[model samples]
Target: MKRKSAKKTKTEKLGLIKNILLIILSFLISVALWFMGTFKDQTPVTRQLIDIPVTIVGENVLTDKNLYFNDIGDIKVNATIKGVSTAIFSVKIDEIVAVIDVSSYASGEYSVYPTLQNIGTAVTTTKIDSVDIVIEDIVTNQLDIALEVEGKPVRGYEARPDLAEYESTVSVTCKASIMEKIAGARIKVNVDGKRTAVTTTTNVELLDIDGNVINDPGIKLSVESVSVRLPISLIELN
Candidate 1:
């Protein structure tokens, strides 16, 4: 009876050991499959991204020389990128920046090549189209600054410029073509419903030959603002 009991205990121990071995073998197989699936090389993908913005790097190079771009023809491009599927799909439109360096070039027209940046190493830029750009030299000019009063003063009051106290001259720098178009600079003062003299500082505006305001970002003025004193007086009715 004791020998039969011992034989039964040995059989139970063997069964338990076999079950544990099976479980360990299954776990190892699962781990190997996961590692193979996660670390395997993926197929390369090619994507054509369009209308990526072309930026001017070292724009200060031109600005410091008192020069500016007259025409940046076709300031955008289509990019062809080749990379692993995962990386190409994860890229954002804004993440790609196309830049053209004009630092070494002077004021003139030329065909420039643009380079891409911020794209990860997993991806490679295959192709980028070139662009034509024009840079122009800026010219300086001095013009007489005038003050114009807008809106009628309160009833029985007249507004006039205090010619004795104001900035009469302003120096302006801009492209030569633009400089030729500028007729003068003026500061506009509003005198609505005012019976007393109005004294304040206001921004000056560049005007074309026909008195239309010239709004050119490339234009630089020595003084951005000016002080004005609009002398008001009682109008004696005759």
Candidate 2:
């Protein structure tokens, strides 16, 4: 009877040890699963994008109303974005588009909000609350086109931009503010190294009264370019 009791006690001790081992293994597995779940890219992320282009919509409305844009603030925007890690990290700058609608607006300055497009399932907040857009009534003008020479001809050659014959006049159209800044319009010609005459079409350039180049997109020319006939001759020999 003493030996039987001893054997039973040994068996019970073995069973208790097995149960404890099983519990420990289960607990370790649960901890490992928790760690995998936490680190498996299921986290949320936030990021910022800069210089994303803003698409201007409904500008044709202004044209239909005989109006035009004198100035539009930055065409690019910066925004903060938020989403799941994979989606947010995969977002591209070009794929993001900010848009502003001016259809309901008239000829005046407006502070407007822009909406986002193409950023999938991501929430966005723009850095700027509003963008300023300046619209005005359109004006038209008819001006004779001429040539403005840049760069001297190569040594021993002479270029006569003045003698260049292009008799076609162009129609200039813009806002009143831009119209006031324009004095004349001419085609820019480069005479840097011309051994012969140039008979090609060139883009028209707008100039202020001081002969400084006026680079405003608001200035619209009826004809973008005009035909030219510049004469070149040998002036000296080296």
Candidate 3:
């Protein structure tokens, strides 16, 4: 009985050793697989950025009456990259897009986002050093036009309509800079609702696209209203 018990003890010890060795071997194999996956190859990747929509809001635009605009869909920006095969495989195109916010711009010119900014120039240390991008505008029309007037007198009496830098119409539609001053604006006057020539001191308004008046809000006119000189006898008429 004593001999049998000793043999049993030896067998149990051997079994325990075998189990520990198997565990260690399995762990080593797992580590080797992980390392291999980290760096398997080196190659270039080309991905497409599809329909990345963005919105731009701007102020002081004219789009009413005869002027209008049609908003286009969100813009699309694409890029092609080259890098390590392992890193490239995990490189997500969507992740790259997550770094840019171009929704604050209006219908005009703008530069690409600088955060995920593609490498414009390549260096010797990196596989892919630059990125190229194409940006487009999404256009929309807003109906709020403001007309501004500007022009100085020849150098004498004040201007009647006060044409020295003021909004003509509440709004009009055109390019931003073009809306400042319009050409060929006129003002007509008729005394006593009759087509007669009369000179008097009165604050009248000018014409705008909305048919509003620019009163004599303290801004003096270099040229006064049209007038006709009258004789003393005519001035004393009953």
Candidate 4:
């Protein structure tokens, strides 16, 4: 009876070990299934976005340093982004922001790398290695304003160019390279068929020393217009 009881106990122990192994295998299989379901699509994918605009910041720095930038017209670049398939595919062209800070840059051309923003967890490897940005030194000058007569007065009246009175000087602001080209500011008054003296304010034209109009969108004046008074002289007949 004792030998039989010992053999039964050994069998019971083997059964218990088998049962424990089965339970652990089942738990491991369930965990593997859950992990596969949760992260099956977590593999990263890449997408290319075109024409991503570049925004410049810290321009007040340039202003403080007396520097200016040219019209970098519609500046754009392409970026190769990588992330989870769902996240990367949902990225929009407008949502991605590329910025470059020009505060530390001096007056010259520079190849700048833009910092990407607004992309949650995605990564960017832009196609454009670096954008070429040109910084120019600003040149400001004070020029004397002159009154120019454009048209003749009525039959008995003659406009005297020398008798005109107006603002003496104005501050002209332009790029340093174009500063020497800008000579003087003049307001041309039209006195066609006018018997009375003209007194009003009008916009001035930037003229080179050779009397050619220098029109530039970047040019700014101290005032919008200059006041003028031109006295029409009556011609005397002998």
Candidate 5:
């Protein structure tokens, strides 16, 4: 009877061990399935193409040592990018840009900083190779100069201070399109052969109805005074 009881107890112990092993195996298998599912459905972030508007704010002063001719006004830039779908979706257009320096350029081509960042993902980023930019020349000209005349020519020859290579006033050139409008130039001339003695300051009109001069109205010309020396022989004849 004792031996039979011992065998039964041993059988019970074996059964319990088997049950525990089975439970552990089942738990491991379930855990493995869960891991596999997660691996197969990996969520990735992908980038999207979008236009990001940027406005640059700065001061314009030619006297400033760092100021550049091309650095005036605002500049526009275009950008595009691609990344993980989730990352791209979460990315804000405003967060992906950087400022560019145009202070060194007086007049010519330029390149602004491109943006690179990972919006939603820890491993990827949307990128722009480089911003293609061009800085134009900024030019300022003085207003028209007040005209003045001096001296006189011969008696027979009259003094024509109005004869200009271009217009009388100094025309200013700015933008390329505006510069094309500059035409005509003129200068005060005194004919000594005509004969006369005179000196006086005059207000010279530098521009024409067409906004041009005889030569390049866009240029500035300086005039001191009008003078003419008339020979005694010519003066007597007059």
Candidate 6:
């Protein structure tokens, strides 16, 4: 009986050892497979990165020549990159930069190809959409800067326009085509809940014919800001 018990205990120990070995072997096999799949350069993969901004290189050259793009239609493009599966999966959208060199081109309409930069050596750009760029001459115009009064004075109070003091005119430099579209420039001042005269300064903004705000960085303003003085008077009702 003692011998049988000893044999049974030895068999149990051997079974435990075998189970542990099988588990270790399975784990090793899995790790080896993962490493092979991650590092191996298999077939090429394609990825489409969208809305990549097309950088306008050498734009200062145009500025020096008093030329600018009238309409840089769709300053963005979709890039198709091809590379090994690992490289494609590792690439980020920001890693790619698209640029178009307009330094050599003058004021005219032209179709140009955008060059890609910062792409990994393992990856190659398979395709990119062409861009239509219209270059126009830059022009400076003198515009009357008007004051825009926002909100109303307190009840029984009136605002007087005679006391307002500000620069009546300003110089605007922008693309000739854009200059033709601009209606005027104005500085916005708020008089909401005001019981007395108020004086303040504010920045200037350009507006289109329809009163839509024009926000173009290339448009340079001689006076970016202005000052305004508001004189309020109390009205007595009979």
Q: Against the true structure, whose lDDT is highest?
A: 6
lDDT of each residue in 1-238, candidate 2, tens digit only: 9999999999999999999999999999999999987776667777888777777888888888878865465578777777777777887767877888877777878887687787786554535445778888889999887677777777888898768888568898888788998898888778777778888888888889998888877777889888888898888555
The superposed Cα distance between candidate 1 and the true structure at residue 200, in angstroms, equals 2.4
Residue pairs in steric clash, candidate 1? none
The order of the candidates by TM-score, greatest first, is 4, 1, 6, 2, 5, 3
For residues 1-238, write the lDDT of model 1, one tens digit per residue.
9999999999999999999999999999999998876665376878998999888877788889877776565578988998887888888878788998887778778987688877788889888887888887889988898888889999999887764257878999888878888999998899999999888898989998799999988788989998877788898888
Over 4 Å off, model 5: 1-11, 30-45, 57-106, 111-113, 116-132, 143-238
RMSD of each: 9.8, 10.8, 13.7, 4.2, 10.2, 14.1
By summed lDDT, the worst window of 10 consecutive residues in model 4 runs over 120-129
Candidate 4's displacement at residue 52, Å, is: 3.0
Q: Report clashes for each candidate as comma-separated counts.
A: 0, 0, 16, 0, 52, 0
- Candidate 4 regions exceeding 4 Å error are 1-11, 24-49, 81-94, 120-128, 177-183, 208-217, 236-238
The predicted structure with the larger lDDT, 4 or 6, is 6
Error of 3 at 40 (Å): 8.8
lDDT of each: 0.85, 0.80, 0.38, 0.82, 0.46, 0.85
Cα misplacement distance, residue 179 of candidate 3 (Å): 7.9
Query: After superposition, which runs of candidate 2 have C-alpha atoms over 4 Å from their true positions?
Result: 1-44, 71-74, 126-130, 139-174, 179-238
lDDT of 1 at 24: 100
lDDT of 2 at 43: 72
TM-scores vs. true structure, each candidate: 0.56, 0.48, 0.31, 0.74, 0.42, 0.54
Worst 10 residues of 5 by lDDT: 224-233
lDDT score of residue 32 within candidate 4: 97
| Candidate 6 least-lDDT 10 residues | 67-76
Cα lDDT for residue 23, candidate 5: 100
Q: What local lDDT score does residue 108 receive in model 5, on the 0 to 100 scale?
A: 51
lDDT of 6 by residue, 58-164 (tens): 78888789888554655788889999988888887886778888878888888877888877788898999888888889999999988778899999897776668
